[model samples]
Target: MKANKLTTAIGEITTQGYTVIDDFLQPAQLKSVKALLARINGQFLGRNNFEGGKTERIYSLLAYDKVIQDIVEDARIMAICEAFLEDNFLLTTSQSICIHPGETPQPWHADDVFYSIPRPRPMVGLSTVIAIDDFSAENGGTEIVPGSHLWSDEKIGGDYREGDNERDSAFAERMASQSIALEMPAGACVVFAGNTLHRGGENKSNGPRQALSNQYCQPWARTIENFFLSVPRELVREMSPKLHSLLGYSVLSPFMGQVSGSHPLKTLEPGYLPPVSRLKPPC
Candidate 1:
């Protein structure tokens, strides 16, 4: 993206809490992703209620699919993450979200609740929702309340629920009323601040709505998905240096993400064994 466009998109995220970019992936790229998902169909896990009982979710997608790996490292998305989350952020999670028909709307809430800081603070994380299929109102497009990121914890009110997801019914309804469903063509992406109030819409259409959800967080925070365990060391070594670093390979200064006292990337070296006896301390 050009500097002007990038600046505009960041402005939207700052003011509206989200922004959409169309044609993020070419048709050929989307087709390849479809083929990959089809090939790995059985590995998808089924979840209930909060996640939509009929929905099928697949985690560790980057390891099983190269297309997703590329998407995660897309410059446009990374720009937004770095702008909001600082340069030293972590790739927290990446998953395939398929909302099957008959699925109900997820309760409205903010993604930032997972972090320790209270709301209205500077963005600690960011999320990108990539549409694998046309995101229509009937097929469960994401619904978001514009500018809700500016809302304080007191404004949201009531006690935070389990999963750090559910908001009070009345509060959610008010937020939902102001919300707009992000309907976009298959290949578009909606990038939003972690504090933005949003949810997956109900799927009244006959088919399932598929999407890819990628999240990034401050480097010091624990990632929602444990990529180190999910993507094996051999596969991790195969990823680009940028992606590897996003997976927390580089330390966050003095001691974080160290392996036997050195940076975690050393563990991916061909001859680096795990035994502490052969380890080298940090300089």
Candidate 2:
């Protein structure tokens, strides 16, 4: 990635809370993912109401489909996430989002609202929604409220749950007026701060819309998905060290995320024992 591109991505997330980049994936890359998605389509459909009655979702994608590894761990996107969430951030969730025809819009809500942190802190999460199929307003593209990331908690006026689509009539109308559907070509990516208010758009078209979300969060926060258990340990060991760390193999300083007083990765190595250094307190 060029320095200018990194700067621009970070700047967009900083000022507008989001940025859209086309051609994030090569044609070959997109083709592989599309095929994989097709193979497993509808197996995980209608699991949750927030996912729209007509829509379907597939979780633990990295575990099932290896083709997405490069896209999920792309250095360019990681650069933006690292800057936004600071050092030691971790990939929190990765899933396929398939919105079928007649699915309604999800509620307006921020991803980090569950953290319970006081507002005005530097970013705690970052995300990218990668389009597997071209996103169109008629086909359930994502909807986002520009600049909503900068709004104070008080301005939001109340509590929110997942899939809210702005439950308060007044608030919903006000937010809906400003929301814009994300229309982009397949393989495009929309990077955004988790604080930004957004949702999946309604799908009026006859076909389904496909996309994938790769989410990152502050290291100290609990991940939305339990990657440790979901992704097998044997497979995790085969990933790069950076991925090991991102998957939470590395400890969070003074013993956070430790497995028997050592890095979690050790468990994957047969006959491995906890090193004495890890047993000793930090000096």
Candidate 3:
């Protein structure tokens, strides 16, 4: 992306809570992603309503294909994450979401709801959703509340999750009235502040709507996906240094993410073991 466009997109996010990148993926990349999803996406249904029982998600996608790795490290998306988060921010979640027909609209909430920090503050994270299929009003395009990222905790109220209670009907309607169902071609992407209010829309169309979602958070924050456990060490060694950093191999400074008193990357060395693992049992 051109510097001017990048600046403009960041401005939109600052003012409205989200921005769309109309050409984030090429045709070839789109086809490859669809193929990957076809083989893996529907392997399991969401376990709960919050996960959308009617939907399917293939988490840990980066382990399956290089294309996913490419998407996660895309410079354009990284630039946006850089604009919002601090140095050494880590990838929080990487997965594919497929909303099947009859799936209800998800309860409106912010992705950063996990942090328990007051809103109206700088977003602790950033999110990106790339359309894997054409998003339409009738299908399950995401619906976002413009400028909701800046709403205070008092404004969010008790109706929202983070408490896990059912969303209040009146609050749902109010947000519905404010939301815009995101509609874009398959290759486009939308990047938003983690504090923004949004939800998956109901799928009235005959077919399912699919998308790829990646989220990044401040280095000190806990990630939704534990890449260290989910992705094998061998695979991490195969990935690029940028990915190594994103996967928690890098630290926030002198101490965080250290392994056995050294940088986490040291663990990747062949035959390396944690110092504790090498200790003999008390004899």
Candidate 4:
């Protein structure tokens, strides 16, 4: 991203709460990612209405394939993230979302609601949704309320659950009236503030709609997905040092993410054992 173009993107997120990069992926990159996905047999259905019962999600995608790894470190995305989040930002969630036919609209909510910091604050995180297939208003294109990131808690949804999206019909109707479905081309990416109100639209098309999301948050924040347990250390060792940092192997300061008083990256060493494991049994 050029300096001027990058500024425009940041401006959009600052004011509109989101920005769409029309050509986030190259032709080759798009083809490569989809080819890999085709081999994965995407049949894992969501277990709840929030996760979309008819949708299939492949989580921990960075550990799934190389194409996904590349996508995570894409230069343009890193630029966007670096602008909103602090140094050593971590990947909060990474997965492919495939909304199958008949999937219903997800309740409107903000991605950073779990942080509980308060409303109308600067975004603690950033989110991305890269379309793997062309997204259409009729095919579950992601919908969002423009400029809602700056909305106060009281204005978000008064009749909803205290900290979650409300299932109340009136609440849904109010949000639906202001919702704008994102209809984008495959390979395009929509980047938004974590506090922005959004949700996956109902899939009314004959075929499924596929998109992958890679969300990032401030380094001090607890990641939504615990990558340490999900991705093998062996694989982490093979990844670049930058990825090592993104996966929480790097400390925030003197020792924030330290393992056994040692840098977390040390644990990725071959045959490494915890410092406590070397202690002799008490006599």
- Using all chains and alpha carbons, the TM-scores for the candidates as numbered come to 0.92, 0.92, 0.97, 0.96
Q: In candidate 2, what are the lDDT values of residues 1-283, reduced to their tens digit?
A: 7899889888888898899988799999899999999999867666455666778888878777667777778889888877877566788888899998888887778777778787655567888899999999999899998888888877766444545544577877777788899999999999999999888888999988999998889889998889988998878877877777778887777678988766677777976656764476878
Query: Model 4: runs farther than 4 Å from truth?
Result: 158-166
Per-candidate clashes, comma-separated = 0, 3, 0, 0
Could you give me the TM-score of model 3 versus the true structure?
Answer: 0.97
Cα lDDT of model 3 by residue, 1-283, tens digit: 8999999999999999999999999899999999999988658898876778889988888889999999999999889888888888999999999999999888888988888776678898999989999998899898999999999988877567653334577788888889999999999999999999998888999999999999899999999999999999999999999899999999998788888789999999999989988999999
The lDDT of each candidate is: 0.83, 0.82, 0.90, 0.88
lDDT of 1 by residue, 165-223 (tens): 44366766676688999999999999999889888998999988999898899888888
Put down candidate 4 lDDT per residue, 1-283, tens digits, no spaces. Answer: 9999899999999999999999998899899888877888466898877788899988899998877888898888899999888888999999999999999898787888888787879998999999999999999999999999999888975543343354687878888888899999999999999999899999999998989999999999999999999999889988987788888999888788888889998898889999788889899
RMSD of each: 3.4, 4.3, 1.3, 1.6
User: Which residue runs of candidate 3 sit more than 4 Å off their true CA positions?
Assistant: 162-167
Mind sharing the TM-score for model 4?
A: 0.96
Clashing pairs in 4: none
Q: Can you give the lDDT of residue 192 in candidate 1?
A: 93
How close to the true structure is residue 234 of candidate 4, measured as C-alpha lDDT?
A: 82
